[model samples]
Each structure stands twice: as structure tokens, then as C-alpha cells.
Target: MRTQSVLVYDGDCAFCTTCVNFAERRLRPRCESTPWQFADLAALGVTQQRAEYEVLWVTPAGRVHGGAQGVAKLLLSAGKGWAVLGALLTVPPVRWVARGVYRLVADHRDRMPGGTPACALPAHLRPSAESPATAD
Candidate 1:
């Protein structure tokens, strides 16, 4: 069997969580799912600050994927119909299109569900003075 990868995503973002939940239901039987957290990201060699700025995925081969590419990879690994989607996403033009869409969604995420400042950083877990600001 192919080695499964670790998916890293924002646990607080409702939209993100919803999508992950869907993926989990469809992919869980095949792969591993891991919530994106400061410690887990750090251990994966990805800075918490970086992960906070975007979604990430760590392939079993130690390769890292982010954004639409990450999602495509996850679906592809999930087996069945998504596998075809993943394969198609790897094509040059399709890959470009996929990334572009991912960028649009990510850029406008603040307007999407579970995108409020409170959701991004709940009062109880606000960033400390030492934490790095969001990446540009």
C-alpha cells in the first residue's frame, strides 16, 4: 500500500473545517488527517507562522504541498473519483487553474464562513507579542 500523507489545516476556520470534514469522511479510510497546529507544523519543518498563513500537507515522502495542490493531492490519495481529479490537476494548464482558484479562495477567505477575526484568533488564544505577524 502507498504511504499516506499528513494533512495540515486550520482547525478553527469553519469553512476549512467543513471541507476537511468532508475530505475526512471520504479519505479517512485511506489516509491520515492531522489538524494544522503550531507544534505539528514546527515538527514538520514548516514554521507555525507560515502554516497560519496557508494550508499545508506533508507527503509521506517528506514533500510539502499547499493550497489547491495540497487539496488535489489529498483527493487523489483518497482513491476512487477523486483520484482522477488529482491526476487531472497535475496537468500543466489544470494545475495552473487549480492554483489560481485556490489563491482566489484563500485571498477572500476572510469573507467566507468562519472567517472573522475572532475565528482566526479566538480571544483565549490570541497571538502573543513574540508571535510573528501574518506573512505577506
Candidate 2:
């Protein structure tokens, strides 16, 4: 059985919403997938600006994932055919490719659904306010 997992997505992006909606419908019964708005993330302790930038997933282990890894983790947790895709994406060569692809998608998100010219976060999401480093 799958433990509780949370997928933090950009609720404002149409493409993201479409993909998340598809995941919600397809991954139901095996996992729980929900749309998370910027406000929702801020309420969860993620900054509004941070949440607007990348896709986040809170794993069953309570660890957070971002970027391509986050998307693969979500697919892994979802089970079904996606599990295979996740595995493939996690492979060394594929992982590199996946990261590149993720960057492209993220960079061009403005053309996607729910995307706005000002949707990107000014800074990377920090685990804590005091943390100096950031992840992209």
C-alpha cells in the first residue's frame, strides 16, 4: 500500500493543471494527488514566491522533491504504467535527459496553461528562512 504523499503543483498553470488532473484521475486509488495553489503552499510553510516557481512533492518519507526528480517521484508513487516511466527517467543517462527536459519545460512555462508573465518566483525555495543556499 502507498503511504500519504502530496504533490504541490502550480494551480495557475493550464498545462500543469491538465497534467495534474490527468494524474489525479489515473492515479486515484493508488495515490492521492491534489492541485496546490500558491496560497495553499504558503499555508504549508512554503513561501508564495517559492511555490510559484517549481513543482514540489512531499514524499511519504516527509522529504521534499523538486524539478524532474519530483515529477519522477510522483510517477513512482502513482504506480501503474507510470512506475515504469519513473524508473526509466531515474536511470543515469535518462536522468540527465530528464533534467534537461524539465528545464526546458519550466523555462517555457509561460506559454503553458495558467502561466502568467509574472508567475516565476524571484528566488529559489529555501528549506528555511535562515538557510543561505537555494535549489533550482
Candidate 3:
């Protein structure tokens, strides 16, 4: 059985890898970060499509939070100023805005520093093309 939460990200994206590295070095979030391509998605109860779409936080109990919520959960686990920020991100209006901001950044990640064209989500995997429930 799992103990710590697993942070699943797109390892194929250099920008994503860079962000994860920064989080590890600076934020020190309490989780094991792994690229989805290298993870056992089935064991983590994550789908390939979903993993490809956004960052994922998979709790030991099997709860899966994606995108901005995933980021919030990661921060919450950090247990400090980051936890405070994570709490703020979960507030109704703040959560909504964070979701939008996360999407905006994710949509343009391919243009971000260290990012490559491979960082862009495929058409079928885009949020507009596939809903969360159907992503799997």
C-alpha cells in the first residue's frame, strides 16, 4: 500500500521537469515526484490521458487531485507558509481564479522557458476536447 502522495507530471516537457526541480529544491513539498511516463499509473489510479493533461496529486488513500487543485494539495503537504498559500487557493473564488490561471499557463507552457513544442497538449487531450470524466 502507498504511504506518501505521488506527484505525477509530464517528464517529456522540459519546462515541467524544470518546475518540478525548482519545487524540490525550494518548496520542498512532501511527496515523491515522478514523471508519468516512468510511473505505474495503474497503481496510482491515474489514467494516461489524465496524466498527460495536467499535474496530478495522488494521495495514499487513492484520492486524485488534478491541475491547480493538485498544486494546492502539494503545497498543503509542505506544512508552512506554503500551506497557508495552499489554503488560500482552495477558497471558492480563489480556487476558481487559480484554475483559470493554471489553465492559462498550461496552455502556453510550450512557449515557456525550457519548454519545447512537445510540452503542448495534443488536440484530443486538450480540456475543450475532453472532459475530466471522459479523459480516461
- Model 3, position 37, has a per-residue lDDT of 81
Rank the models by TM-score, top first: 3, 1, 2
Decoy 3 TM-score against native: 0.87
What are the per-residue Cα lDDT tens digits for candidate 1 across 54-94?
77777767788888878888878878887898888878999
Who wins the lDDT comparison?
3
Tens-digit per-residue lDDT, 36-127, candidate 2: 64335544445555456677776556566777887888888778888899888889999999999998988887676766554443333322
lDDT for 30 in candidate 1 is 55
Model 2: colliding residue pairs = 12-114, 13-113, 13-114, 14-113, 14-114, 15-113
lDDT of 2: 0.67
Which residue segments of model 1 deviate by more than 4 Å?
Answer: 1-3, 27-29, 113-136
Model 2 quality (TM-score):
0.69
Q: In model 1, what are the clashing residue pairs, if there are any?
A: none
Quote each prediction's TM-score: 0.75, 0.69, 0.87
The superposed Cα distance between candidate 3 and the true structure at residue 84, in angstroms, equals 0.7
lDDT of candidate 1 vs native? 0.70
RMSD of 1: 5.4
